[model samples]
Target: MASCSNSNELLSELVCSVCLELFQDAATLECGHSFCKSCLDRKWDSEKNSICPKCRALISERKYMRNNVLSNMADRAREMQIKGETNEKTQIKPSDLSQRAEVGNTDHFCKEHSEKLKLFCKEDETPICYTCVDSLKHCGHNFIPLHDAVSIYKEKLTEAKFPLETHLNEIEELQEKQMQRISEVNDQTKAMELHIKSEFATLHAFLQNKEQQLIQKLREEKERTLKEMEENLRCIKEFSDTIQTQMHDIQSWLEQNDALHILQNITAIENLLTRSQKNFIKSSPKLVKHGITLGVYKGPLQYGIWKEMLSVINPGLTSITFDPNTAHPNLELCEDFTRVKNSGIYQRPLTDSPEQFSLCACVLGLEAFTTGRHYWEVEVGQNNSVWDVGVTQASSNRRGNIQISPKNGYWTVSLRQGILYTASDSACEALSAKPQKMGVYLDYEGGQVSFYDAGDMVHLYTFTCEFNEKLHPYFYPGLKGSAPLKLFHLCL
Candidate 1:
């Protein structure tokens, strides 16, 4: 009897503290404590920090060494204790112990009737024997075969796990996409930074301050976007972990063959599924990284700055004059070649030159610009019934009837009858008012041509295109207009 008690004490020592079960596949931690390998692993995985379950020591490295000696001792102790043998040095293999554990106990019997519990009592929420069904204690309770009850509960658990599995998959996919987006964001930010730096490096000295402002703004935007993406990733991971734990619990419940145990807390399980469904709907995480834009930094950026610089620098307009050689027969130029008008009759001794306009009463500027910025003004009579003033490409047609459009390498604003119209591929757009003193500004490298009312410098219209050839200032004094088109004094 004393030996049996000692044997029980030895068996207790072999039991793992975490699971309170005889150690199976035992593992030793760095802290010199032992536990069932699966128990230790589950504990560590569920916790944020890894620590020894017995000693409470923080585990720096997760190395689980299999304790072969302890495992063999635990198997021998469990086998001898179960078989009521008091042999301390008895040899028992792990497989022998596993086979003994696989053998299940007999079905439980009702204490009062001493009969097998084969029926489930729905009202009492427990298994009862056949004799107990007619007893006054269970007189009015509903009952079903134990097998049927197990089947029903297991089916319900199985059905509930499907949505949880799908929800977990979606969250995992979102996590992968979010990680990819983070990498892409970094690449895009670096590329944009280089582009901005190169652009600002070419700008004037005064723009150094503006360059710093833009860089700072870009950094702030990147920080904000990354923060949002990371937060979304965290949320997705947290929800994914929650679903995984719930599904694990449900699977365990479904694997149970015992009717009474499987049906226990059935209402709580249904409530859990309901909560998961609601949370799945509400906890949808999205990756939100808005694209950064240059805003005012784009589209006629340099031109706008140059306009601002004009006030401080006080740079004057460019000096430009009409090329009389390119004038039509009926167009007469002033002695200074600064003004032109369409005379009623054609001049004698007709000269048909390639540079001359044969049909339209138009004249080209003496200067041909292929690069840099140029701004010139032309004065038209306030009540001029018909006139055209803008820039045209040097290669454009100057002979016969021609369409004054961008396709023909011409960009002009004209007045027909009494309304002002700007030419385009689709159709001509009418302007609210005509500019008597018209300002035509051309940015060769910037790919922009803008017109303004020279009187107040109010912007009128602009055209953007890629320039591949030399450009010339064009003028047309309508045949029916009373006033001539005259050039303004030059300023540089």
Candidate 2:
């Protein structure tokens, strides 16, 4: 009875505190506490931080070992308890003690047949005794030794984990690259901002220098005109003095008492009068003040400056011309290739090539751009009610009727029936004024295609895309009008 009491006390110590039951699949923590593997996992999962269940010590790392010794002892303790409850005897026999000792030697036994589990059912994936092989539940199931099954499954698990590890490594590498790219973008933005500021500063300095030059020129002109007027004033003073001297001489002669002296001086006076009249007519010319004007500076000051700014601009405009090789059959290209007009009739016996457009009345530019900024203007006459202007990828279809949109590698805006619309599924907003001349600006690296009114400098529309190939300037001059589409160099 004392031994039995001692066994009961040991069993209580093996029980799990969380589930209040015998520990199944016992696991031991670093803090020397033990619990069922599942119970401890549940406790840790519900908490933000893992800790020992008994002592509540912080578990920095969730590393635990399976308590194999504790697991065996628990199994024996359970069996012993079950046997003791079924057979109540006050005194313990030697055979009973021997049997109790034998129970601790093996790990698991069949619940129904009380035989050691030695075989694993491959189909059922459960440990079973030899007696269970012929049982109805597992009669036809495939079986292997428990030890061999464990080894095989461990190898399979390791094999499966290799691809997962490789995938994880690849994902981590890509994540690092993405982070580096983000940093590079920020750095580039800062550098670009500084460059913009520096460019504007240069422009400001140029304008300031021009203003000083104009002011200096105006000052010099004023000084020259004033000096000429001063010379004219000196001439007038000299002439006045001569006239006063003549009048005085004549007055003195008139006061002479002798009639003979007066008569003799009359001839001299007449000669002097003739000479004075001739000198008066020739000398002392009247100074008519001419109105001063600022010349071209006074007319279209901003426009003049803007035009002059073209010289300083890094890239003023792209001179684009038509590519006759890509022109449609109904299109007529000028000798210079800068102009295209629809002939209203298809030209026959034309040399056909893969680059030629067979359906749409379209013509591509002679130059193709793959990088940097480019801007060009096309003059679509106001009388032409239908026209199209923009850019298209070099690989875009030229054989059939193509829908002009970004999806089709064509970024364009078209006018139909006197109304303008973007070359997409939707219509663009009404412009303030119709654009007779359309400007196309392409920022290849920036992935932007912008349209503007070349006449008024108004923004028409913009298309954003990721360009991966060569892009060409696109033009479509409808057959309804006799107006020819002409390309011109423009300043930004």
Candidate 3:
């Protein structure tokens, strides 16, 4: 009777003190206290420093969203309150409370046989009546007294939930880190793009200057060649006039005087014409064209720029190969171990190793990194309905069906049933878009790993983590579908 009264008394705590009724849109404060969202907002609006109603802790702001955990508790509280009110309206007396308390004592009795459920069947994981234990369902199954089972399972539950709070804190920290790294990567990529544009502008300016210099030098050489030809033309005109004058004089001597006069001047005229022919032959210039040939530089300008850009992009692509020792028996590697898919045949290889995955269709990269940045792309074709790609610690478990998450030595994003997911401890968060091919970027010293659309900078997810061991690029081929995941040797 005393316990029943105390149980009824504890129900009042869920009510908002200001409203003196159930909370509507419940939200919790940081100080482990909760109130109706409207009530808290009103309280802060009426006051200047907006402190907690129960405790004088300074409320950060008047605006707040509904607390999901508290809202769930509020729903249960409302149901309890309604049930209690219904009981009151039914005209229950004080003596009825005592009867209800007494009824709970026999609540464990089996309904069909009216026998006390004193034993627990381990096989069925259920409490059963002693007669039921002897019946067909539990004829020879392991049984424990109800009290013993309660004591045993309660301790196990407690032990299992012991790390729940710590794990929650860790998950919260990881989520925070994941968000921070995403923002950083976005910012870094934007800054890098701007830097690239600035650098190309500078190169373009330099090339333009070089082009003008080449044109100017070509023009000067052309003018020099033309000036020499112009001087030769002046000399040739003067020599031609003199030859004509000499011809006229010889003709006059032939007409006016006699054969003796013509004969005497013929030698001098012949000498003059011969000298003119020799000079013209010796100084004759041939026509030829000259200009800058830009075939090599012009053809490879884009390719040259890309090669120079690689230096700034840093460790863009290191060829990835499967570590054969770590491949699961059901998985097969092709394209020089740069492509992986599941094989229907599950026979273990003759040269067996413990690094092989026993359950998952997984493979690891031959190259492991403890420091530096790396970028790689995977051609995740539309062949599989599910796939996981990311990096994992060298010492990660390969023998069991473990949760592949950051805390469990994996930092991966997954595609399952057309939804993209970034792994966390409890559940994966869905991404906005799905990608066919994915790009992975890792900065070991910065403790960052990021995923993006291989075709564009559409970031999917990122994880920030400090490593204590070497990490290898990890791949999970869809076991049932067996779609190939191909590694790209070139940066996108």
Candidate 4:
């Protein structure tokens, strides 16, 4: 019985009465008994009671606080065993200990100054040591405690990492999508390149054809102009020879007036001179005429006809009628077909139409000129309402008159007191009253009439009028008369 009793005590001491283990996660119960926390939890769960398993003492869950003191004592004992300093006295409770074992020892040193970095330089945005801070270079710079800087950096690091993390994830997803988009774009570009090449080829071919046609047309026009110029030169030379021969004959007859046949020869010479003059006048080259047929281009020789074809090309030729009573006296028509007026002088109203006028000029007899196509341009306007002027023949006039029109604005280029046919086939109508300064520009050369805005400054229109008449008036009255009527000359 004594052996059995000794064996029971040994067993009781070996195993924890509460845990029934070799004392792991050891904790002391309020009843002065010790147990493993897991084992006690297991016991409580199984029995639905908070009583100490070994003593059967009634205890509340509140009494089950972790036994940190015992846990520290156990930790110290384990650590001492690891260090080969095992001792029973080292197993002291955490509550009785004043120090803890060092944990996870690591080293950090400053790269510069070779000393520990203890502060952060706010200006340089770097960590520094006492030596660096006290240096002359850093004397005036701001600094913060390393610990404080670290805390701030930690917060910043968290913030910075959030965006970086999000961007990294987005980059991964976008890389795949980007590859797809690149492939699509490449395919579209290839198709577009091929299409552009095809269009270029077509355009090149079309341009080549147009170039050929233009060359041919230019050659024809050149030949026509050259031929007309040659004829004119020949006519001029023949007239000069005839005049020289007549003058020589007259001189010879005057010297031989004493001859008996002089009387008969003189009469015959007079008759011959009259006949020669008549022939010269009759044989003079007729004024060459030209006209335009406005048409839209469809293909070569194929054109779309706009019923009311408006000429927007060049329309600077104008005709104006002046009333001597209202016209400025200083304005005079020059022999060379230009109106000479005082620079700043304002002439009377060329037309009675509200005393307001805008210049519109036209070639009256384009067919009389050898030139096939006539072109002219004008510049008008002072302020915002200004527009570049242009003129071109809208159509050919078979009635010995050229139809001229304006391109920029509405202008009247009509004959003063003269009759004008409505169209090529229309009958002529007389201008009983003075029409709006129709179809004529101010004759700056004649000094007769001047054009102006409400401000009354010279606003001249430039133009070219081609006709057999060398002395062509820049301004022609909208009406025609049996007697010669005075007109203004275009300056340009």
Candidate 5:
């Protein structure tokens, strides 16, 4: 900073006043004013009197002589300014070295006592002078040599660093997953936007209202999903920032070696480290399940959304509860019609209710599927026991043992001995995979019923038949089955 100021001051002296440039063919006029020889000559040629161009000072003669002494001074000033700048940047000032050296001067005396910091008080975690070691403040504290204390703390610091670094790596991995989720959201929203616009184009002139409605729904979903994800991302970012701050503090503390200051701050660092080691990897952003309902776009434009909804949209997931009036004696109906488990002994029929299942340990959902596409999922938790689950004709036989097949008005699948069995008139096809959550999709018009592994949408089986009777979702918690089957939470 000082070098720049001096350079400007020197340059001002070297420059010719009239031209504002370095002296060229430099000469002095009789008025003791310096100007370039050509400038003086141009003034004499253009003017009627021998007057200075800058102040209009009268000169004794029209002739001007070259000042060799003043010219040399100007040349030297420019050279010195350049060298001064170069040296200022490359060479360290004495005061700067002194200032920097003061910070790392641990080997020196204590700031308070002005005596050598030879002893380290372990309890306080700081270096102290001999006077401090003997003082009442450190009466019961254990003291060690400065060098030994530093060595011990360094090892401890190294031990702490390994786990923090591992946690840092996990935080990075979580950040990466967060980004992937963001990209998935972006991709899904883009596809939805394009699909909506294209579908609207097909119905261009007739259904502008419907088009705007669908597009508006798309915008709402985009905003809602992104808002949730951004909030999650923000949480992860806040956690990351906290980890970084703690890391920096620990590093600074480790480098300082000031036992007194270290003692004052060590507790915070330890607490931070303990917190960081646990729960370092937070919940990253994930796409909301059933975030948007398709009814907004689907009611008016059925065909366009139906096929797409099959894969992307969770449509018409009706909330289904078991009907106690239809439960068999052996089957225990849980509260809220969500779960069922089999008991060993079968109780006698409570009443002559026609809706009750008299023979089998099977039950029916409260609502019957009369029309439209309906979807629902049941949690068929892990077990090797026999269990039956699917849709059944509402008026199907509930009296005696019957083959659970389409011909018997039961379009269903059974799990027996770790194998999946779909019943038909021909024979049951053995399924390879066992699903925890069973998804059932019923299309009354298509006259089709299909099942899936709800978690991944892996197809299990499809039953083809013409439905003339009202259908109800069915379940058979077999006598030998141990685990309870639960209906998944579906929208109202």
Candidate 6:
């Protein structure tokens, strides 16, 4: 028994009875025998015996105790190993340290969930914990093991850094370009402002000049009209005085009852009366013959210089006519010739029937004439089939030849020049003569007629006479002579 007891002691010392190896977590069994803590626990469980394995002594089931000293020693060794690994890792360069840190952080705890982030998303390359992996939000998403994913993402991050840096550099370049564009736009805006200001200044000056010219013209016309009115009044008063004198002389002779003296006085009074009557008739008709007058001729006229024939006549000679065969033939008539609403009809030698006849006049200084296009309507008539006649100006000849077709009611004329012409288009014809006074055959209503350039509108000029022949109408320069010209037939 002593020898067996010795052998058992030796065996206990040689091997851990619980672990079956050396006594790594050595502890004493309740029988005062020693064994490893894990091995004894295992033996107790397997045997269903609460007795010491060697001593055969009964042991209480509740007396199992952990060997804290042995556990502490093992914990210390594990700590030393972890520390050695950590120190070795720290020896790596900062760049390598960053790679290690990235892998560590990806498997780190989530800030929001307070759970380990382990599963890595291949798409976004982010780590997710078990909670996130099972979540419906990330269902069907591509994922990989955390460790493997971390290594791959680290390499990707390293590769992406170069492109990211280049992108940042490109961003700076674009910023510079944007700044340059802004500066250029500012400069262009300033230049545009200056140009607009210059144009406005020029326009203002032009308007001022035009205003002055119009004012001057108005003043001159007013003065001339007043003077002519006074002269007409004087002529009317003289005729009245002559009539009164003749009547008084006749009354005195009748009251005397002296036959011889009465006869002599009557004869003398008759002679004086006849002479006075003739003079009065001539002067009175002149007073009643004045017609309406328009302002100066400021528009382009093919021929004829515009002249003020009457005090009220503004600047342009509106119309004129001459014919010897008519009752009122050989007359050169002007509207308001004496400035008394009376017109003057002067008889003159008739012109020979020349091969060609022409008439022209101007409506110069007319404000209605602008840089754009203008239109005019004219009517001409004679006793025979009128040949081709046209209206034209010196500046431009494109809008000249307006024909007055017999089929067309009236001829339309345009003042624009240099327009292209086809077979259907009209060509401008130049006027042969510039006539303040125009000549027409007396076989019919013989007269040259034109429009006056009243700044506000166009006034028609007509020449009519009592004749017995059929009159043919002619229009100088036709636009689309197929259509009747719009007539400004308002009589003043």
Local distance difference test, per candidate? Answer: 0.73, 0.66, 0.60, 0.37, 0.67, 0.36
Give the total clashing residue pairs for model 6.
Answer: 32
Question: What is the Cα-based lDDT of residue 254 in candidate 1?
Answer: 77
TM-score of 1: 0.42
Q: List the candidates ranked by TM-score, beginning with the highest.
A: 1, 5, 2, 3, 6, 4
Structural similarity to truth (TM-score) of each candidate:
0.42, 0.40, 0.38, 0.22, 0.41, 0.24
Off by over 4 Å in 2: 1-201, 206-318, 348-352, 489-492
Put down candidate 6 lDDT per residue, 1-492, tens digits, no spaces. Answer: 455334333332334333444445666655556666767677777876676654456787637455655455444544554577323322222223223233233225543333556566655445666656655567788877665653443343344334434433444454444444444444544443343334234334434454345445544544454345445545444444554454454345434533323222333644654654454345341332222222122222211111212332233324222111221221222332211100122233333433112221111111111122132323321211211222222122112232332122222222323221211245434333222211211112222233333332233232222322223222222222122111121111
Comparing 2 with 3 on lDDT, the higher-scoring candidate is 2
Name the lDDT value of residue 450 in candidate 5. 74
Q: What is the C-alpha RMSD of each candidate to the true structure, in Å?
A: 19.8, 42.7, 47.3, 40.5, 23.4, 42.6
Tens digits of lDDT, candidate 5, 119-217: 888888777887677566788999988777767766676677777777677777777777777777777667656656765665466567657776886
Better candidate by TM-score, 2 or 5 = 5
- lDDT per residue (tens digit) for residues 36-131 in model 2: 999999999999999876656688788889999989987876777667752443323323332333333333555444456788887876677877
Error of 5 at 251 (Å): 3.9
Error of 2 at 253 (Å): 99
State the weakest 10-residue window (summed lDDT) of model 4: 295-304
Cα lDDT of candidate 3 equals: 0.60
lDDT tens per residue, model 3, 1-492 = 665545444444455556655567787777667788889978888898877675456767654556776666657767765677435433223233333333344345554334456777777766677567646667779987766765554344344333433433443454454444444444544443343344345456545554455345444644554454444444444444444454454344334332222222444544544543453355432222212121211122222344445543343455678888888888877758888888867645734455788777788888888987676778888667788889999888888676788888999988778778777733344545567787777768767787766655455666777887899999987865566888854322
lDDT of 1 at 416: 79
Q: Estimate the lDDT of model 5.
A: 0.67
Candidate number with greatest lDDT: 1
Q: How are the candidates ranked when ordered by lDDT, highest leading?
A: 1, 5, 2, 3, 4, 6
